[model samples]
Structures are given as structure tokens and as C-alpha cells.
Target: MRIQNAFRLALVGTLGVGAGLLILSAVASLSTILTYVGVALFLALGLEPAISGLERRGLPRWAAILLVVLGVAALVAALLLTVIPIIVEQVGELIALIPVIIAQLNRVDWIEWLQEQFPLLKIDEISEQAAAALTDFFTNPDKLSELLGGVWQVALAIGSGVFAVIVVAVLTVYFTASLDAMKRATYQLVPASRRARFADLTEQITQSVGRYVIGQVSLAAVNGVLSFAFLSIIQAPFPAVLAFVAFLFSLVPLVGTLTGSIIIVLACLIPGVGSPLTALVAAIYYLVYMQIEAYVLAPRIMSRAVRVPGALVVVAALAGGALLGILGALVAIPTAAAILLIIKQVVIPRQNER
Candidate 1:
């Protein structure tokens, strides 16, 4: 009887492990779908504040949502219509100038200086070899075919991206429309005694997320506008395209602005587009701008949005980026804030009681 009981226990343990593995496998398989759903939900929460604001001003909920959505759609359409073609043209120009840029690099003062410093290093030889390799790659049929295959892959990826955008957009609208209902349903799952508290915390969390999204976007817009103005003034290459790039990168947390600034400065150094003095001036502007952004703009804008500590923000952004790339980074700060709120309201109190 003892042996039979032990055997039964082992069988159950094995089954439990198997079930757990199967569940994990299922989750892994559904990861992409899950990511889309998560992004949609995040965006819905972000739009909630605007919808609520409109609702407060005597608009019906449906009308408020419709207006906000239409406004956003219009803005997106306008940007695409005006900016995309210019960006594409600028990109083509950049690609066409690559050989000229490479040839110019061989004559750069820095290359000569580096060669002077390192007597054994043959900078010209390396540059020539690189140029030759590039020329050979372009001329070779097999290499050209490989390049064509890569282009096909890029085309497929773009198609997939468009499908993803559509999916996320539709999901966002659905989630936004039913968000209140969803919340109520969620509250119902909690015990009556705890439901009110849960609902309150949920509201707070969602509001924080919404405000953060708005604040972040506002910052990005500021950066984009300033970047465009500055780049134009400096006669930098593709001002509009570079500004758009800045705006997109600024949407990410922590390292976004710095990365954008670096890219812009590098672009300023590109042969035919900008000179070394132009790049230096652009770099200086960005350095000062970053300081202003850090000390002034971010604090003022983000103060009401989320009250995360600087250290925690860095850690959360890094961890989130590692886990889910940009989306993870975007959500990480709010997730941390939500966790902190729960810990303060629930965990600490429980500990005190104990």
C-alpha cells in the first residue's frame, strides 16, 4: 500500500510537470499575438485620458472616442503624405553618395593624423581594399542576386509590419471602446471587500500610464520641432527626415534622445551633406539641449505623469528593453510605478500587520 501510494504521487508529479511545460510552449507559440494585444491595450490606456477629458466637456463617450481617433488618424495620414516621400528621396540620395563619402574619407584630415600617429597602420590601403570590395560586390552577379534576395526579405518584412499595424490599430479601437466595461468586469473578479480598493488602484495605474504617454509624446514633438529648426539652420542633410528620426527615437525612454542626437551629429559629418564644423556645432547644440531636457523639460513634463526614481527608471528601462525591445521599454516605467503603488498600499500594510 505504501509503495502504491508513492507510485501514485510520482505519477501526479510527472503529469503536473508535463502540463506546465505544455502551457509554457503554448505561451511561446502565441508570443507574437500576445505582443500585439499588449501593445493595443497599452495604447488604449494612453488614449483614455483624452477620451475622458472630452467626455467631461459634455461630449458623449462614443463621440469623444471617435473624435480622438479621427484626429490621430488625420495627423498620421498628413505625416505620411508629406514626410514619407521626402524621407525616401533623401535615403536614396544618401545611398547614392556612399561611394563619394567613402572616397572622401581617405582624404580626411583625421585619417592623415591617425596615419601619422600609427606609422605601421596603412589607412589608405585599408580604404582602397574596402572600396574595391564594395565595387566587386556590386559588379558580381552572385552578390547582386544575394542583395536582391535581401531586398525581397525586406519587402516581406514591410508587408508583415503593415499587417501588424492594422491588427494593433483595430485592437486598440476595440479595447479603447470597451475599456470601462473591461475594468468593471475585472473588478467583479475581486471579492466585494477588496473590489473598491482594487478598482481605485487600477484607475490610478491607468491614469499614470495615460499621462506618461502624453508627456512622452509631447517631449518627442518638442525634440522633433527643435531638431528640424536647428538642422535647417545648420544646413544639415535631410532636415525633415532627420527630425522625424529624432521624434521617433525620442518616443523611447532613457537612451532615445542621446541616440537620436548621435545619429544627427553623425549625419552632419557626412561628406557633401555637412562639414566637420557643422558636425561640431550640431554636437554642441545637442549637448546643451540634452542638459536642458534633462534638468528642465523632463522634470516639469514628467512630474505629474509618473513619480519613478531616477535609478529605478534606468533599471526598468534597461530590463524592459532587454525583454521586449522598444515596447517593453515604453511600458517598463509604468509597470514599475504600478508595482511600487501596490507594494506601498498592500505589501507594507500586510507586513506591518504581521
Candidate 2:
């Protein structure tokens, strides 16, 4: 009897260890899958407002979900068809014009001043070396192979991104279609006594998230349009490309607009395409725009959805970006807002009552 009991205990221990290892392995491999699911869930939540509105207007829930999905797909397809070719062509043009830009830079007064002062600045040598290096990289087989390798990596990345997008799209559709069911199922998980409060909190959070996503997208659009206009006014060669960059970067939290604006301004100062005066003008425009966005636009757009302190916004953005790169940065503000809402509604109230 004693031996049998010991044997049973050992068997249980071994099984537990095996199960633990299996679970860890699964988690490690499914990290990316989890990320995709999370992104889709978040996106569904963001689109909930439109879905709810349509349902309120007497449309069937399924029809509203389908409509919202189709509308989003059409918008994305249209944007890709219209903007991709222009960006590609502009990128090629920019690359081809680099030597000319460098040559133009050689004639700048600052170059001459640096040469005169430092004596060892050797601007001509540096320029020549840079030109020669570029020429060699194009003409040399080994260097050309490196370029091809980079292109291959880019292709692989694009393929992976497409796969992720498809997965997210499918999941988003499923989640949006079953959102109410999901909510009810979630509520069922809570204790009967707490379920009502949980439902209310969930609803509030989802509504806030929906508003935030919509507001952020709108703000990004505004930034992109403004950037395009500013670049065109300065005769910047790649206005479309710069604007697109602005649109993408502006999707991130606090630092995104500033980062995009700086990049565009620097592009405007490229020697062959733009003048110092144009760069200065671009800089000034962004400075004023940032202030206006902070004081006026953001408040008008985002205040209703989520209001977080400016310092907290910065901290959250930095931390999120550090942890998960762009996606982290993009979601950080809303996540912070959600956390804040919970603390305010649940924790603080509980503490005060106690």
C-alpha cells in the first residue's frame, strides 16, 4: 500500500511537469497569434460605435457589422490603389536624385565655412568618398548582393504583414459579429452579484475605446492633409510620400506628430529639392501647428473620448513604444485611459467608501 501511494505521487508529479512544459512551449509559439487576436479584438471594439448606431437605427446587428467591415475594406483598398504608386515613384526619384543633392550641398556656404575653420574638415573628400561608395555599391556584385538580400528581407516582411492583416481582418469580423454574445458570455463569467457592475464597466470602456480610435484616425488624417499642404507650399519634391509618412507616424501617441513633422522638415532641407528658407518655413509651420493641435484640435477631438494628463500621456507612450514598438505606442493612450477609468470608477470609489 505504501509503495503504491508513492508511485501514484511520482506519476502525478511527472504529468504536471510535462503539462507545464507543453503549456510554456505553446505560449512561446503562439505569442504572435495572440498579438493578432488582441489587435483584432481592439479594432472590433473601436468599430463598435458605428455598429451600435446602425443597430439603433433599426438595422439588423449582422448587417451593421457587415456594412462597417465592407466600408473599412473599401476605404483601405481605395487608399492603397491611389497612394502606393505615387509613393513608389517618388521613392525612386528621391534615391536617383541623391548624388545631385550631395553635389549641391558641396556648394553651400556652411560647407565652405566649415572647411575654412576646421582646415581638416575636407568636405570635398567626404563628398567624393560618399559618391564613390554609392557608385561602388551599385557597381560591385558583392554589394549588389547585399542590396538584393535587403530586398528579399523586405519581401518576406511584406508577406508576413499581409498574413497578419488577413488574420486580423477575419478575427475582427468574427468579434464584431458576435460582440453582444461575447459581452454576455463575459458577464456570465462574473459572480451574479458583481455581473451588473461588470457589464456597465465593460460598456463604458468599450465606448471610450471606440471614440478614441475614431478620434485618433481623424487627427491623423488632419495631420497628413496639413503636411501635404505645407510640403507643397514649400515645393518639397515628395509631398505625397511625406504626407503618407506623417499619416502613419501620427497614428502613434504623443511624440508621433512631432516626429513626422521633423522628418518632413528635414526632407524639405535636402540640398537639391529644397532651400534653407523652405526648411525654416516648414519648421515654423510645425511649431505653430503643434501648439494649435495641443491647445485646440486634440482637446476638441479627443477630450470626449479619454482625458489623461499630459505627463501621463508622455510616460505611457514612451513605455509602450519601448515595449512593443509602434503598436504599443498606438494603443498606449487608450490603454492608459481604460486603466484610469477603472481606477476612478472602481478603486478610488471603493477606497473612499471604506
User: Cα RMSD (Å) per model?
Assistant: 2.9, 4.2
**C-alpha TM-score for every candidate:** 0.89, 0.83
lDDT of 2 by residue, 272-349 (tens): 887788889889998999999889999999999888999998998899889877778878888899899999999999
lDDT of 1: 0.94
User: Model 1: runs farther than 4 Å from truth?
Assistant: 92-117, 121-148
Model 1, C-alpha of 146: deviation from truth (Å): 4.7
Q: Give candidate 2 regions above 4 Å deviation.
A: 1-26, 95-99, 102-117, 120-148
Query: Highest TM-score: which candidate?
Result: 1
| Clashing residue pairs found in predicted model 1 | none
Q: What tens-digit string does per-residue lDDT give for candidate 1 at 169-233?
A: 99999999999999999999999999999999999999999999999999999999999999999
